[model samples]
Structure formats: structure tokens, C-alpha cells
Target chain A: MTITILFFWLSLAGTAVFAVSGALQALRNDMDIVGVSFIACVTGVGGGTMRDLLLGATPVAWVNDPTDIIVCVTFAGLTVVANKQIIGRRLDLLLWADAVGMALFAVLGAAKAQQYGAHPLTVILFGAMSATFGGIVRDVICNEIPVLFRKEIYITAALIGGVTLLLLPVGLDDAFKLSIAVVVSFTVRACSIVYGWSLPKYG
Target chain B: MTITILFFWLSLAGTAVFAVSGALQALRNDMDIVGVSFIACVTGVGGGTMRDLLLGATPVAWVNDPTDIIVCVTFAGLTVVANKQIIGRRLDLLLWADAVGMALFAVLGAAKAQQYGAHPLTVILFGAMSATFGGIVRDVICNEIPVLFRKEIYITAALIGGVTLLLLPVGLDDAFKLSIAVVVSFTVRACSIVYGWSLPKYG
Candidate 1:
């Protein structure tokens, strides 16, 4: 189905971006290869796994097939090998990747829930959860405060994307819904990153 | 089946102990009431939920049944309101409760995995994951390195208990298996806590 294809590519992009973000984070924290691989795999599938668990979709996406986890591990390995140039001097690269990954996951996650017949509100919740929880897990494991809890506008972007996907006309194609969701979500996040925009925080 | 009773009691004990541990941890970190309840619920069911997800069981246990989460939330509320002598100065009570929870989760998690037909190795892994991961999530959210990561000998205790449950004679009553597992695991942990035992960490 067109929906499946939409999810397939969006999920793929999300996984790739998430893996890079995690690997770069691990490198920054000076974690060894094992820790890097662990963080990468966790970030890569953590959201989707949580989404499926919430939906009562058994056999969590990666456990039913090790392929995605394996890919994530490989990406981590590659990042480690290219540490000096790609991850070291390019911290901004990791941030952009994280934003893009967050965008894709927000759309894809809500879409999956919709396909499973969840209500629009539930879809929005699942989408935001999928978008942000991975980064939460990653930062938490590294012993840092979660980004969402900090000044970042991460949750807002995911929520916008999820609501946008839900409000689209029913006559629209699934692919069209997914595409628009990404554009809006990614643009919001990308602008935030570039402009150093952040939500107000009490010091 | 007798196994059902074993799980019922162990799960009850697990939920209670996990709730207390979360509440105590929250109080120590100066979290407000909402944060306290959130951490408590997450710690209370985080492990078993992970176990079911890994086993491809859907709807997660608490999502399908709200009773456990409600209990955890209430415990958190009570801990916050009953703050003075019980939870404030007597951190030891919290540690003891955590030990009991670790023991129960270890036994019950492995037993459930076995009942679900997981491999022997997987049963052990899942049991350990179920027992310790809740604490890990708790600590992470509180912005501290997990007790397991630092020097508490937590993983060792959980692994010993899980393997003990797995190796118990099948002909024995499930309740007996559960009891022996608890005794072994709880004893080890209590000793470690009382004696200030810790695993060496490289700085």
C-alpha cells in the first residue's frame, strides 16, 4: 500500500538521522565503541518500538527483525571510524540530523497510529512521543537533562507535524500527507536551529 | 495455574517497592508532585513493560490494565504528602524497598519469560532487564548516573536471581521457585547495601 511505502522511506530517513545524532553524541561523551553502538541502536528504533508497544502492535519492529538494529550499529561503527572530521569538527551536523530525524518520526509515527485506527488525539500523542522520546533516552543515558526539558522547542515541532497530518483532507494521498508533515516539521526545527531560537526557561 | 499466583504476588510486591523507590528518589532530587508521580509510574512498570515488548506481547501490561499505574501514582502522592520522617531522613527505607523490588522483578520476570516460551538465555536476559531497567530509567530521569552504573552491585544481584529461578527444579511449585529466587536475590542485595559493597569503577 502507498501508506506502507511512505512509512518505509520516512522511517529509513529517521533511522539514519537518529543513528548519526546518537553516534555523534557518544563521541562527544567519549564513550567507547560498545556504548556508542548501544546508544545508536537505542536512538534508531527506540521511538518506533515505543509507538508499536503503545498501539499493541506486537513483535516490536526491530525485535521481529534484527535488520534495523544491525543497520544502526553499522552506522555507529562508521561514525566512529570517521570521527575526526565528520563528528568532531561538525557538531552542527549532528544537530541538523537530530532535527530532521525528529521531523520524520513525528509524521511517520502518527501515520502508523492512524493506519491502526487510533483516534486523532491519540495519533498526535504517539507522534510527539515517537519524535522526542528517543532523544530523551539518548540524553538520559548520557547523564544529561533531556532536551525536551531544557529550552529546546523540540516537542512543539513534533506536535505541529502530528496535528498537521491529522487535519489534512481525507482525500489526500498518504504520501502527500507524509511529505507535507515533513516539510512543516523540518522547517520549524531547522529555523530554530539556525536562528538559535529556544523556549523561555527559568534559570 | 500455580504460576499465576506466583506472578500475581511478585508483581504486586514489585509494583509497591518500585513506587517507593521512585518516590524516595524524587524527594531526594527535589521534584514536585507531578514529577514524583511520573517517575514513580515509570519505575513501577517500566521493566515489566519492556519484558512484554521484547516478548512481542502487546498493549503493555499497564496500558491494558490501569490498576497498577494508579497504585503507583497513589503511592507517589502519599509519599509526597507523608514526607517528614518516613521518606525524608530515612533513605534506608527506600533502599530496602528497592532491594525487595529488584528481587521480585528478577524472579517474576524470568518466570514470565519462561511461561511465554523464551529461550533459557533470553529468560535470564529478560529477567535481568526487567529487574534493573526500572531503576536505570528512574535514575536517568533524576539526572544521576544509574545506581547500577556506579557501584551498587545491582546487576549482579538481578542476574543471580534470574539464573537461580531458571535453574530451579521444574517439578517444584512455582510459588517455591519464586520464594527461593527472592531469598537469594534479596539477601545478596541487602548484604551489599548493609556492608557498603560496590563494584570498582575506572574514572
Candidate 2:
């Protein structure tokens, strides 16, 4: 179906943006080329990897196809080359792209968990987890507190997307429901970024 | 037969020590009870989890049998209760136990990889990875530089164990070979601790 193809392209875009974000973080840490590539690959695949491993999905997505890994490595190369040429606003741009990818992954991860007959609560958890886990790993590897646990509207958006998909009528087309979920998720994230919204911190 | 039983016991011991070490770390970071339990479970199984996921081993060991998680939670609770009474010497004691666990994991990980028909080099890599990765995850989650990457003989000790296991004659009993590998690995790590051995830092 056309919708399936569209989802494929979007997923690849998500993987690339995530990879670039990871590579940028590695470069900031003064890592060598190999480090940058490794981090990028891990960041791109980490969330899905965690989800799959927990679900007993073996040979995970990247291991089976490898297209995602190729995309990650390619983007890492580009980020390295572009590092000196751009500064300051690059992160902001990537954050926007990351939001799109995060939203897509939220739906995809939830849907996959649902297909596997996971509990409803678990499905939502996987959605937020898959959207946010890679970034958590990236920050953790860099020896920083995970941005997810820090102030953010990130996981909230993913949760919203998952909930929306779960509540949607079964009569709706799969692709149509997924698209709606992605939009809802992306809009919340975009608004949060624009307004600098964040959840309250613990006392 | 006796060797297999001994390995089962040692693996449990390794799991407990790693959990206790993680709980102690969580307490040091002032984490809440939930965070302490979470980190403890992750640290206890993290290395083997990574090995299984990478090897496409489904239903990962911990998920198939909940005993390890129960052990982790129980130890975490004990650590929380014992925190005040055990002060400076606790870490030293835990480190010794961790070295034993690390050695056992190195041999076990390599052996599993070989069973799966992994490349010889990949077998060695998995050995070191399964030995050190739990600590790496624990450090990363706590926002500290991984002790493995820092100045230490940790991974080298693991690699030595892996190589020793691989080179052992197939005619030897599996139990004998495994025990010999563990002894070799533990001795190297013990020496490093006593003598302050470390790989050279980059210039």
C-alpha cells in the first residue's frame, strides 16, 4: 500500500535524524570517528532495540534488515563533515526533526506491541519508551542525566499519541489512525518547544 | 554435574553482587526507593541482556525465569537497610565479588556465543562485553563515566578469560576449562586492584 511506503520513508528519516543527533553529541564529547559512528548507530536503534528485546523479538529490526544501520552510519558521516560549518542552531533544527521521528516511532512501537498482544498499559509504555529511550542512552553514554528524566514534554507527547491510537475506532484504517496519532504527537511536541513547556520538578 | 551446579550458584552470586552494587550506587545518588530497585535490576542483568539481545537470543534469560529479578529486588532491599551500617569497606568487598562475577560472565558469555556458532573473534568480544557491560550501564545510568572505559584492567581481564577459554583443549572437561578460565580472569583482576594496574592513557 502507498501508506506503508510512506511510513517506511518516515521511519528512515527518523532514524537519520536520531543518528545525526547522536553523532553531534559524540563530536561534542571529543570522540574519535569510530566512537561517533558507534554512538550514532546505538542512538538510532536503541529505543526499538530495547522494545524488541523486552518483547522477545529476536534479531531485532536493525539486525535483520541493516538498512537502518546504513542510514545511521551515512548520517553520522554527514554530521561529522558538517560539524564545523554549522553551530548554535543546528541542535534546534535537529530537535524539530527529532520530534517528527519520535512521533512516528511512538505509534510504530505501540502498534507493534499491540500486535504481539501485550497489555494495553504495556503498549503505551512501549510507545513512550521507544520514542525516548535512544535519547536517554545517548545522554547516559555521555555521562549526563537523561534528558527524558529532566524537564520535558517529550514522553507526554508520545503517551498522547499512543492513547489516541488505542482509543481510535477499530473501523478506521490502520494507516489513517497512525497518521492521526503522529500528527497529534508532533503538534504537542512542537507547541512545547515553541512555548518552552516543561513538567513540574520534584521538590 | 557438580560443576554445572557450581556455575548455577556462582551465576546467582554474581547477580546478587551486581544488584547490591547498583543499589549502593543508587543510594549514593540519593535515588528514591523505586529508582534504587530499578537500577539494581538493570545492573544485575544488564550485561547478559545485552549479550542475549545482540545474539538474537529470544525471551532473554531473566524474562524466562524471574528468579534473577527476585534476587535483585531482595538484595536491593537489603542494601537499603544496610546502607548506614556498612560504610567505607563495603565498596571494596563488593569489588572483589564483582571480579568473580565478571570472570564467570566472561566464560559463560563466550561459551554461549560459541554454542550459537558466532565467529571466534565475536565470541571473545561477547565474553568481555557480557562481563563489563552491566557495570557500564550502571555507571551510565548514574551519570558517571563507565569504569570500564576509565583507567582499569577490567575488560582486559575479561578478554584474557575469553581467550583462555577459547584456547583450552576441547578434550578437557567443560567444567574444568570454565573453572580454569574463571581463576585466570579473577587473578588478573585481583592483581590489578592490589597493584593499581591500568592501561596507558592516550597522550
Candidate 3:
């Protein structure tokens, strides 16, 4: 029960970070406040919703627990209200925060998939999905091709982190594995952003 | 076998119509030929792709049947070439064609769900999804709230059509039910467009 509670808190924090990223993207696109809030909500929870539906989970997580919605709405509202003052000239900060959120989501998604009896490959896919799908939804909503299909190492980093967790010793503490996965994902993404590292494009 | 063949043909025809609608939308948006073709492919098969993934079907339909991809691509290519001259002044025609495609996909999605042993409600939801999801994806790509969300009668019509099929007498012929459902959905959508019918909203 304690482990579950800890994981839940982590997931909520991840959602908050992703929501901010989405809000910032919408702001950059010059969307209205409503659009910003809508995009943020979709980006933060879209992947998890898809995962739950695919796994045949009933009631869906957000529908059952309104806290997720409240958190997203609050964060999105705050971003919109403080767009110019709060986010001014700090684009780099937003990117790093987003990376942290991505890492947390990847670990949480992998752990949940593992609990649901998904095979390792599927769990990895879920992890990548959790990490990248929010951005995909945001891009799609903003009328752009998803960055995942572009020249980014985003999904790949998530997969690496997920695999690390899955391969960890069975008896090791869950928190340790979770921490390692998150740190690995964040570090890889941060380095990729700083160095502009991306996957090779196919001709 | 005959029934399956009938549905297969119907779905193909639906795809073709959907491709045309997508192409028209892209043209209206002033997209280049490649962009038009890309949007067309997405609108033609996006819903079925989502449905298949949710159902855990291997090798997704388009991947399994090369012909499906061929048909979608060919239609997209043709539309791209002819869009400027042929589709630029045919908004009404595009809407009607899209209605036909929606009707066909809605029934087909329901049929597939039933085949997969989904419950009646789930089958109905699947049918509505088939009709609406492709448009949702198209609108999202176009950076708009999904037309289905804004258009009151669209999804509701599909749901009604699906439920109508579900309530048919046991052992009845599949063709009769499918034809009826398709006709009902198309009529509803066409009339809604013609009369500008919209669901009532309260502030």
C-alpha cells in the first residue's frame, strides 16, 4: 500500500510537469487560454488514458479520480495567467522540467504495465508511450507532426530506462529501481537536448 | 465468407470516400501536394488503426493487407494531383462524400467489434469510434477541436446506427441490417448538414 501511494504521488507530479510543457507549447503557438488549458490536459493524461483503455481497465483513471483533472486544470490555468511574467526568457528551464516529467512517467508506465502482466516488450513500449505520447498529443493538437516521428531520441531514451528497470534484480527495492530509471532517462534527455543529439534519418 | 467480403468491399469504398474528404480539407487549408496526400492517408485509415491496436490484433489491418495501403495511397495521390482544379469549388460535395464514408465506417467498426466478442455497448462505442475517430485525427492534425465534438449529430447518429444493428433479430441476414444502419446514419448526417441542425447547449 505504501509503495502504491508513493507511485501515485510520483505519477501526479509527472502529470503536472507534462501539463506545464504542454501549456508552454500552446503559449508559444499563440493559442488562447482555453486552448492552452485543453492542450495541457490532453498532453498530460492522454497516454495513460490510452494505455488504460487498451488494457481494458474500467472507469479510466481520471474519470474515477477527479484529482488528476483538478491538478491539470490548476496548473494550466496558472500557466496561462502568468504566461508572460512567469515563463519569460526561460525556455531552457521548461525543457529540463519536461524531461524530468518524461522520466517519471516512463518509469510509472513501465511499472504499471508490469503489474498488469504485459510482456517485457509491451512494457517497454508503454514506457516510451508514457514518456512521449503527451508531446505527440500536444503536437497533433497544435497541427504539427509528432516529434517522436521526427529526428528525436525521445522514445529511445524512454525505452532504455524501462529496460533498465525490468532487468533490475527481482529482490531489489522498488524505489531504488524507480530512481535509477528516472535518473537515467532525465540524464539522457538533458544531454540530447544540450548537444542536439538525434537519431539518424532514413533517406 | 460472403458477408466478410461484403464488409471488406464496403470498408474499402468508405476509405476511398474518406481520402477524398481529407484531400479536400488539405486543399482548403492550402497545403502542398505531399501534405494533402499525407492527410488523406491518415483520414482514410486512422480509425481502423486505433481500433485494431485496442483490440490487440497483430499486424494491423493495413499492414496485413498491402492492398489497403495501396488503395489509400493511390486515392491520396490522385486527389493531390486533381485537388486544385477539381476539389477547390466543391465543399458541399466533399461533405456529402464524407457522410457516406462515416456511415460505412461506423457500421463496419461495430461489426468488427462484435466479431471480437465485445459487449453490445462496447460494440456500439466501437462503431461510433470508427465513424468519428478518423475525423478527430484529421481535425487534430488540422489544429481544430474534433468536428465530431462540435458537430452534435455526427457521433450520435453513428451510435444510433450501431445500436440499430445490434438490436436486429437473431439469425437475421447481415446484409439487411448493415444496409439499414448505413442508410440511417448517412441520412441523419446529410440532413443535419443541410438544415444546420445542432444540439442545444446551455450556458
Candidate 4:
């Protein structure tokens, strides 16, 4: 029961931060409040929606329980209100929040897929997709190249986390395993950000 | 039984034409052969996938039956082989084929949603999404503004078709109603292409 409650709050936090990141992007592009909210909501739920759709899970997460959408709209409004304070540092803050959200969702997505009996390869794919696809959609909507397809070591971080989770001993407590996975994913992403690490581009 | 076969063939044709359109765009962008095929396959199935996901129809059409993917890949290859022959008129051909595909899919999407007991408004939304999302994904992957959001009369055409189908007498034959809806959508889109008709832009 405690573990379930912990996951619920963590998922809410992840949704809120992702919403803020999307809203910041929309504001940067000079979109109005409606566009900002739309982007925010889509970014918050997009990854899990994609995962559920691929796994034949119906009524998606948001449609079944709209807490995610409500959180998205609330955070989007908050971001707009706080716009002035974060003006110059918006991009930096967005990246950090996104990293945290991505890390959390990566493990969560893999866990959900595993419960649904997806193949091991599919679990890893869903993990990376749930971590990166929201940002990809946000960038695409803003008419930019998706960061996932860029040279950034983004999806790789999620894949590493997923593999780590799958490789853990079955005897370990679920919560402990999940915590380790999230930490591993976040550390890789944080290091990449601070060190400007990237994969080599094709010639 | 005959109606089912007609719908099946129409769906295949729509998939093929959409794939061709996506491959042409990738080729114009100088994408490699693999990239072209990837874009083609995504574009061919993207719209229907979006509709199915939103309507809580899982295992999506392509996953349940791989026929659509097969058709998309075959058409992508054919487009590559015919590249030189259609170089100069590629854009025109793509637009025409896209219009037909969009019209066919719009009615089909609406019909599917109706069968699933979706509300009228939801049915119409799914119809427009099914008609335009493939092109939207294709443009996004290529880092261009989606034509659906351009001033073009794209979604409007699909909406009109969906409403037409819904308003038809309940006594009408299913195939006849679908045929009429497809024609209406196609006519609207064809006129927009020929005369450059567009929606009014925001001031």
C-alpha cells in the first residue's frame, strides 16, 4: 500500500514537471494561453498514452482517470504565472525538470509494460519511448528537430535504466529496484547535460 | 459481405497512396532509403493508429493484421523505383493521392468510431484525426509545419464528411452512405487544391 501511494505521487510530480516544460516551450514560441495549455497537457500524457496504445491497453491512463490532465492544466497555469521569474533561465530549468520526469517515467513505463506481459525488447522500447516521446512531440509541434533524433544521449539513458531494472534480482523488493533504476537514469542524463556528452553523428 | 470487401480494398488503396506520398517527401528531403521507408510506413498507418488509440481500440489495425504494413512497404519501394519518372510532378501527384486517401480514411474512421458507440462529436474528431494525422506525422518527422495546421481546408473536409455520414437517413445502405461521405470529402479537398482555397488566418 505504501509503495502504491509512493508511485502515485511520483507519477503526479512527473506529469507536473513535464507540463511545465511543454508550457515553457510554447511560451518561448509566443503561443497564447490556449496553445500553452494544449501543449502542456499533451506533453504530460503523451508518453504513457503511446505506451498503452502499443500494448493494447484501452481507455488510456488519462481517459480512465483524468488526474493527469488536471495536473497538467494546473501546472501550465502556474508556469505562465511564474514566467517572469524564470524568463532568462527558462530553458535551463525546463531541461532539468524534464530529466527528472523522464527518468521517473522510464522506469514506470517499463514496469507497466512488464505487467502487461510485453516481450523484454518491447519493455525497453516502451521505457525509452515513454521517457522521450513527449519531448519529441513537443519539439515537432514547435517545428524543431526532435531531441531524441539529435546527437544527444537521451534515449540511451532510458534504455540503460530499463535494462538495469530488468537485470535486478527477482528477490529484490519492487520499490528498491525501481528506485535504483530511476537513480541510474537520472544520473546518466544529468552527467550528459553537465558534460555536454553526445553520441557520434554519422559522417 | 460485398461491402466488407469493398471497404477492405479501399483501406488498402488508401494505405498505399499515403505511403507513396510519404516516400516522395522523404526522397525530396534527401533522406536515405531506410529513412524513406520508415517515413512511408509511419505515414501510411499513422492516422488510423491515432484514431484507434484515441477510441481505445487497441492492438491497432496494423498490429492485429500486418497487411497494412505490407502494403505500405511495397508502395514505398515502388515509389523509390518510380522516382526519376515522377520527379518534376511529384508534388502534384502526392497532393492528389493524399486527398483521396484522406477522404477514404475520414469516412472509414467515422464509421469505426460510430460502431464503437462513440459520441457524434468524438466520431467527427476521430474522422478528421484519421484523415490528417499521417500527413501531420510525416511533416513533423521531416521538420516542417504540418499541412493540417496550415491555412488549408483539410480538417474541415473531414468534418464535413463525418457530419454528412451521421446525418444520412438510418435506412440508407452502409456502403452507399460511406461512398457519399468519401465523395463529399474528396470534392472539398480537390477544390481546395485546384483553387488554393484556405481558411482565414488569425490577425
What do the candidate models score in CA lDDT, each in turn? 0.79, 0.79, 0.76, 0.82
* Per-residue C-alpha lDDT of model 1 across residues B12-76, encoded as one tens digit per residue: 77987898899889988988989889899999988888787777776677777888898899888
Enumerate the candidates' DockQ scores in order.
0.16, 0.15, 0.07, 0.13
Task: Using lDDT, give the best candidate's number.
Answer: 4
Candidate 2 chain B: worst-modelled 10 consecutive residues by lDDT: B144-153
Candidate 4 per-residue C-alpha lDDT over A101-131 given as tens digits, one digit per residue, 9 for 90 to 100:
8998899888878888889898988898898
- The stretch of ten residues in a row with the least summed lDDT in candidate 1 chain B is B194-203
Against the native chain B, each candidate's TM-score is: 0.91, 0.90, 0.91, 0.93
Stretches off by above 4 angstroms in model 3 are A1-46, A49-108, A113-203, B77-88, B149-151
- After superposition of all CA atoms, the RMSD between model 2 and the true structure is 6.8
Name the TM-score of chain A in model 1.
Answer: 0.92
Task: Tell me the fnat of candidate 2.
Answer: 0.20
Ranking by DockQ: 1, 2, 4, 3
lDDT of 3 by residue, A68-102 (tens): 65677688888777766855643565576578788
In CAPRI terms, where does candidate 3 land?
incorrect
Reference-based lDDT, residue A72, model 1: 82
Better of 3 and 4 by TM-score: 4
- Residue B51, model 1: lDDT of 82
lDDT per residue for candidate 4 within B123-167, as digits (tens), equals 765576688789888987887666554445776787788899999
Q: Return model 1's CA RMSD, one decimal.
A: 6.6
User: Model 3 Cα displacement at B42 (Å)?
Assistant: 2.1
Deviation in Å, model 2, residue B11 alpha carbon: 11
